[model samples]
Target: MTEAAQKQQSEESEKRERSPGGKFMLVLLTGFLLAIPLFASWLLIYDRQSQSEQAEQSIVTGWGGQQVFSGPKIVLPYKAKVQGSVEQDGKTVTRTEIVMQNLYLSPEAMTFDSDIKTEVKSRSIYEVVIYNSNVTGLATFKLPDDFARSGIDPATIDFARAEIRFGLSDARGLAANNMLSVDGQPLVLQPGRGLGETGNRGFFAWLDATDLADGTITVKYDVKFRGTESLTMVPSAGQTNWSVTSQWPHPSFTGGFLPKNEVTEAGFTAKYAITNLALGSALTSTQASQQVYPQSNNRPYTSFDSSGEPSSVTINLIQPVDLYDQVSRATKYGFLFIGFTFVAFLLFDLIGGVRISSVQYILVGVALILFFVLLLAFAEIIGFALAYITASLATIGLITAYAASVLSTWRRASMIGGLLASLYAVIYILLSLEAYSLLIGSLLIFAALAGVMFVTRRLDWTRTLQKRPSS
Candidate 1:
């Protein structure tokens, strides 16, 4: 062959190499990219160790051993009635009312150390609710019957109390699942002594009801208590001024012997006299209390189970939140974005035969991969929207630059960028949609694939794959 011809042939061969190795690499990359959504879904469902951490961090309240307060002894006498009618199969047969008196006596204690004033003063606030309504009852907290039964004299209890308020209520059609609220708030029990030395240190505020006509109501059972509670709250840096807490016991309600599920919560508010510093305020607390089931012709107030014998009670904290589920929800749309991007790339190459260079493909893949990391990081800092924007912008910039350089056209590069930006926007919209996202995203993917198929219908795949003009 002539030397010039030989050189020309060599150049042609180089141009037409097409690189089977590159195709193989593309196959592998495509497979891996396609697998990302599956892996993400699996991670969301199975590997949510992160959610557990977030839940622990977010829901827990008290840490260090801090005795915020112990109030003075208070005597309380309360009366309440439960009324309701049960109708089954279109027949109103049973109408019942239960009335009872609660005699409560309690010993309270509080701590203080202040240069501003020698003595510390604190006021306790009590609130209550029932059947999503407020039921008023006695405001004063009393000593447990167990204390008097143990032969512990009431005179031995020290005194540092303030004025107490009283309340009464009539609740109708009370059921086990009926909702109870304290101080116009839901109850979330945490591990700590709320008031007394025993686990029973908590207080309850409720409404007064004589009939269902009043609906349930809420009342502020405030006790103008004076004592030292400076020890309950110590200043800590980088902590919220007002602390919030919650807990969910395994079985929910405590059997009648303890703080039952019927009483949603017991919370106290402490204020220091000298510095007037208020701390240990319960924004909300909740717990499961047991239901009192009266057996046929038995002691009226006796709690018995379905077996009709003295039933054992099992209680658990009602921690309703699953942090992992929440975080997973935030990432679901990101996974969808990545999955459809892979599908689009596959469709374009299979039909248009306008193959992207390996480097360009790698750039796009990297952009897709980094999106989740960016989302997780930015979400932790600035929130979901900012995190998504930062991630999408970064990926868009990377892919656009690579597209322009590899496709050798500014217009093509911008086109890819706009398309990617649009896709990201759609993903964000889906993420925000919550319940409707799955349906909308399915339709979107279908439409996108249809467009790709329609546009590339006439392209000659073999010719485009061969050494041809860049039409």
Candidate 2:
């Protein structure tokens, strides 16, 4: 070619490079447009999760109610079934009966009310579990006061805290004798029975009485029982109606439903009776009336702080699910997806040439980001599997369409689209397998990157990133 022709060719190449700006703009626009779903996903799904947590904390901190002390005292009416087996001269003789009525009342309540109205009857060794913690220091039982008025000496009941477990053991020494094994495991008669010690946080209980005999004792303990209390979420109605069944950590409400009318402040009402006397015997229930004040505080949900201060405070019910760990899990999955997409993009670029443009790359990145956003959103609303499908399908469609348009060839576009479809499907599978997402995602990402790296090891980078003149 002549010098003039060569110079003309260089000028044309410069002009083509300048015109690629429009192509870049188109790619960026497409990417931003595709990111809409990702943004939406963040807003809808994760937001609710955070809110639910706040509600949970509020319930714990605002534990309110008319604290009632029901029992430093109870009456046990018995139809004497004294089954005693005395080994007289190595011979066994046993006799027993079956009938007993136990009347239990708070010492404070029994003072003025002399007549016991409620009747509780049990057969086969009925025992009621009582705890000292159930008796409030602020509330004194009226039993002593009544006895003083009646000029009768009241019986002094000294309660002791001791750990107790029950099972059968052969005739062993009472102090440090062999405990009977009921289920092959030596049942501890008492574990941590401290009369004046604090109970486990968020959990409280007391034993009704100590084990009477050590050898071959058939014992029954009250471990779980449901209690009911009325609480008010909103006070405008002048009555509170809320109930909670006492379960560890999170309790379910029976008959205590969410408020029907929409009010600024949330009013909760429910009743829960103590269940599980084995842990702590004396029971006290709390029923609060509209003490939450969610609306006035500007936090309509259950939260300790109005501003939701501990935004990062993560409380996971599942074992091994920590806040930082979950985030790391998500991050690992995301990195794998993006890294794979990058490799795939580069591979497709080599096969299809500059015709695909950097705009296509931007579109692919947007699609990858959307996968995460969609996964998070759908996982929140529906679940991880459904959300992943929705997001992956939408993103794959967007990528395939963009690829087809940019390449201007149905076959080429479809091939790239299929490749992306496969990639996203793998990513979703990784995300779903939460325990192994990191391992799978990492392996897949490395595989893709390695494949691309091996295939393009001999390629010239200067030319790859450089503008090519249209023929």
Candidate 3:
């Protein structure tokens, strides 16, 4: 080949390599490749969060788990005769036998007052919230005068063997030295709930009602217990009223019923009132009452279900700020950060006569993805805000220094640093204002698009193919 022809071929190849079209395609491909590391980093953050949850569970298990209170109820044992057919001497014979059964009764009116004090228990990087609850209440039970209408004789009712029972979901949470009283008489509490109609795990106390002609009994008790996360109470009385006060500022009131009260920064005060009519008669029927027995083989009562009636309220002690959740949210915007910064570099390459290779762009993207890893690691030691700030500063400094070498000017490199700083600030705001993040992010993107359009309004793309000397 001629020397002139070889020179022309070299110039054409050089022009194509530095063309705006070629650089744009390379940036797009680099951005796509960067997603692999970004997603891998997100998975790592998720795995760490799961580990944190496991740590919290361990802490809560050691400290009594969550608690649910079913009742401070009156239960009585009675004898009934059942007639059945049996085979005797190769012939069917009718026999009558006496069988023992339990009659469960709830109070006509009941009132509960609970004072809950919460504390945080931490293990390593995870923390669990637990509470010591002091509860006191009064319940009044009166046998209906027409009780014999249910195929049972009132005179046959064994009032002497009557017992007062209370149900607790986790008996381990019960504090020692609890007290119970029936008609101003102190009674001894036993371990297992005497009434099979109630739950199996709880305390019961015997009370003789033979001398009481009117069949009216008043009971009172004061209980102290410890639990974690949440506390729920079942309203077993015809008319139930509950007043709960807690020192925890962030209490999430959940369950079938909501508190008709207010929550404040210092604490929360919740009140609940439930009526028998709302609870439905099915809950008070003999079949439903018998279902609570430990040997009934029936589905257990849940705080929120059709059969259980769920006439209850629950309060969850929640953390005000969850750092893991915030960090995860920040990582979701990783692509935007990388793409926008790459676009800024491209603009500098196109307008400012700076030459940045595809490899340099990929290196900058990798550094941007590393920021999330740094944030996650630091967040486990420090908090979200400090970790974010530290990671952002470190990344900005590294990328800015690299930019200075590639762009050949400290002034241009400073511009890239300022742009990154502004982006980090915007992301922090978005993270803080979660409800308005979409609106703010959309407006910021629109403004960026407008700025880019204005800056390149007079540029001619045809001139991009013109040959220029290598820098």
Candidate 4:
């Protein structure tokens, strides 16, 4: 072949590789490959979240887990006779047998006042919120005047076997010097709750109902306990009032009822009032209490199984912001960051007559993905905001320096650096406005598309590809 013909053929081959269609297809393939790292980053986020949860659990277990308090109640045992028929000597014989059963009673009126102080316990990069609480309460109990009208003889009641029970979800959380009194007399508290199925894990004190000739009693108690995250109470009384104050600022008031009075910030004070009508007549009868109390067991009272409406106010000691959660949310936008950056590089290559190879595109994407890894690592040591600033500055600086060599001009590289900085800023905004992230992201993508279309409007793809190489 002639020398001129050989040169022309080589030029044609180079134009084919750099054609708009070929470049577009290569960009798509690169995007597909970028998914691998994106998925890997998500897996890392999931692992980190799991580790954080495990750390929280370990801390809580050591500090007597989340607590739920129920009842400063009275339980009375009684003997009853039931007539039944049984086969005897091949014939049915009728006999009366005595059975022992306990009657559960809630206070006619009850009040609880709690003062809680919170602290942070940390292991490695994880921190858990735990608390110490001093609780004081008073409860009044009275037998209904017509108690004998409930088809039971008052004479058969075992007033001597009466007991006062208090339910604590985790008995391990009870402080050593707990004080409980009835009628100004200090009572010896025992381990078992003694309220039969009406109580969970807790301590009970023996009481002599016979001493109260008027069939009325008043009791008071002081409790010091330690727990993690939250404390819950059951309003199993005719009228229940709870006043809870805590040094923890973020309190999640959850349950069947919300606090009527609440002041939140730096610390919180929440008061709840529950009427007996709202609690139903469950506390009046053992059979009813069994059904009513356990029904609330599935509600978000604590980690333990007990029954009531979300009737308790829970003051949760929560972090003002979750750095791990923020990092995870930012990582979800990894693909958009990689895609927009590559598109910008491609635009510079096509419109500015610069050359950026597929290998260079891959390298740039790898660097973008590395930003998240750096963020995760640094966030564990420091926090999200500082880690984000550090990782972004490092990645942008690295990529800008690399681009200067690839594009052969500081001006062009500086533009890329500015673009990257703008992108990082947009991501931070999206992270901050979680509620509006989708709207902002959609607008950004639309604006980016409009800019790309406007810049390429006058260019002829075929002619650009066939143009002589620029020196």
Candidate 5:
């Protein structure tokens, strides 16, 4: 045969490859190839998500980061004697040295009222949560007459240079913390860790408790700070009450201790009533060098900060919906869209007396996959809801128009259009009802299979595509 004759024979043989089994294999094959773009779209969504997170992190860098704070603990210093054997005169002799040691005293009563002002900040297409926390609180401390038990005489306790300490996760958050009043005596704030683990990332003030040896020492403070995302507080007194109110509508409470909380569209109010009895520890320690919150590995004096730890109460200011997350979820349904579109085309070609080539199948499938990319792109600018509608409409229009020519009738093409629109709508519903998505998706598949079974129940499968005419 001539080359042209052989080419015509090959074309005729390819056209003969049609009907139910042929279309099923072709769709399976086409679906396989379409996986590439669907996978690529998923990767693109993650890459954009990572970039958004990096942008938010950069914004937080300029502002203060998450803030975790503790204390109104007293640091009382006293003289102590240490005895050691020394080679003083070419012979081992007992040497006595006097050293100044510190004793940490927690408050008998402590209370704080925190008011947080929140604002949304955007960089590029990313947004971050930032807040200013204004804290006003008071603490009452009482000295016990049991100093002699720690090997320090009451007369040896130096009350003149006693210090009151506090802890914060980030020192940069101390925006307006400078001076405070202790028992009506105005005192200056000095930044540094005085004692042990509790000394991390906070400020302290020197107070003379000599006159209050037989009475109670009181401290009152009003300070302001800046932070992003989360906040944490330590219950550092025998009895503690912390009340926090914020205008941020979305708040997540986490950590070791949960609060009695109320949430509203306007904001949230969280109140914590804690006591040394619930703290699972004592109120005071002699020469406290041990970690105050042992399980709280994230406090910054040790160079760590986490959203929630078991030893402290944490509050997270959160975004109501994560756009990237929703986009990623939408991509997970990419294959469903492609499969349904391919099946719709296959069914119409098998019984509607229309012919659909593998190329048209591929084109429609590609359009379905492209929807994810479009959704992700628009979601960054317009948000998830509007972006879903925009992307779905664009994709549905492109495929429905292509289907009109491929199916050879406006009637069959309209069915394809309606099918695509319905699939998109069901996908949106699945995304919304995350808890029931699996159940609904399974029922949708079962219904599709039942419909296909009913439609082709009486068709003579033994017959090939040559028997059916393009009516």
Candidate 6:
């Protein structure tokens, strides 16, 4: 061969011999195809999660949404006069306008003792948390002494139009067997939000002439109600005491006050004692003025913000672990599994003298992504842990068997299998220990990178390429 042609041929041969970085770039290019399937799997997980949430909301709608109570306040309806301009005989004149208003008096004391029974109701593959609470209440309401002297006429205060207002977030949750009594007389509730302004989300009952004896009213009620997820109480009284007992193991207590609580595998019991002193003066909004209900029943009794409503104490019935969340989290780690497994295969192909085609890389990628699909499907049926073990064993076995066929030895394949097993174990641990997952994952990436760099530190590129023997 001529000297120029021989030099050109040698350079061409060197170009075909890929460095370790160059080989990884090839692997990455091929791995890019995996994104299509990876994204598809992610979307599938999202769709399933959306379906599960929809099912829970469906169940809750048929039952009842979360329940909140703020009630047993005395609502004294009264008439107030306002001056307004009127046109009479084509001339403007001032006239006295008679408007209806109310005086809301907070209860001196309120107590709620509740026993909640929770159960898991399932719709297809979804489970929803629901509860039936048997709540008994005792409250006392006495008119504020200065109501008549709050710049309003005592004669205009219609004591006969007095109502006992009891607030509820969802009135439909009230069971048919509920009972309420004021001053030894049974009260028939009317469908209306008893409290004025933004805190008006409950039912009310009118009081008879003798019900408010000596300007004081006593209320007793036994309510058996069904609700989904959570229950809350508003302490709209001078002193509030609430006790809740539930047959569910997981109870998430939240809101303005933390209850003294005891929890066990069987159930939980929580108690809260809150005084108006802690509630502050906002709870007694418009207490200085007798007019509280509405300008003409078309507007709120007064301007209200969140402070207009009494701060609530809430308890949420939650599952210890949700399978959908576990699966979604696993799906997020999909690329890690793909990248690590590809690196193992790349190591064998480049240094161990194995020939792994892009088509084969694609097949292996398909198998890895299928693991997530299998996990989600079985998780719904058998829960997350067992399903994870099942999916991992199946995926690891499939890849290990294929590794033996491609790498041409049982020993090399065993190494691949061990790597797969370790990855799966690490992922499972990461999922279980969520608070420390980021720390663990960051450490894992650092270790993997260091190992890869160390392994390639002295690797030669000459052996990775097989040029035709010189003739």
Better structure of 3 and 4 per TM-score: 4
What's the lDDT of the predicted structure labeled candidate 4?
0.79
What tens-digit string does per-residue lDDT give for candidate 5 at 244-320? 99988899998767899999999999999987767665666665223322423323221122443336778999999
Name the lDDT value of residue 155 in candidate 4. Answer: 79
- Candidates 3 and 4 compared: the better one by lDDT is 3
lDDT of 1 by residue, 372-408 (tens): 6666655555655776788789988887887666555
The CA lDDT at 64 in model 3 is 73
Better of 1 and 6 by lDDT: 6
Q: After superposition, how far is residue 319 of candidate 4 from its true place, in Å?
A: 1.1
Measured by TM-score, the strongest candidate is 6
RMSD of each: 17.9, 21.7, 4.3, 4.8, 4.6, 4.7
Provide the clash count, candidate 6.
1
Q: Tens digits of per-residue lDDT for model 2 on 299-356?
A: 1111122443311111111211223233224534544555455555545555435455
Misplaced by over 4 Å in model 6 are: 1-19, 83-96, 145-150, 194-201, 209-214, 282-310, 460-464, 467-471
Candidate 6, after superposition: displacement of residue 144 in Å? 3.0
Over 340-380, each residue of candidate 4 has an lDDT whose tens digit, in order, gives 88878887778767777889999999999999999999999
lDDT of 6 by residue, 407-470 (tens): 8888999999999999999999999899999999999999998998788777875445663322
Candidate 6 lands at a TM-score of 0.86
Local lDDT at 226 for model 4: 88
lDDT of 4 at 264: 64
CA-RMSD of model 2: 21.7
Q: How does each model score on TM-score?
A: 0.43, 0.40, 0.83, 0.85, 0.84, 0.86
- All candidates' lDDT scores? 0.40, 0.36, 0.80, 0.79, 0.80, 0.79
Worst 10 residues of 1 by lDDT: 125-134
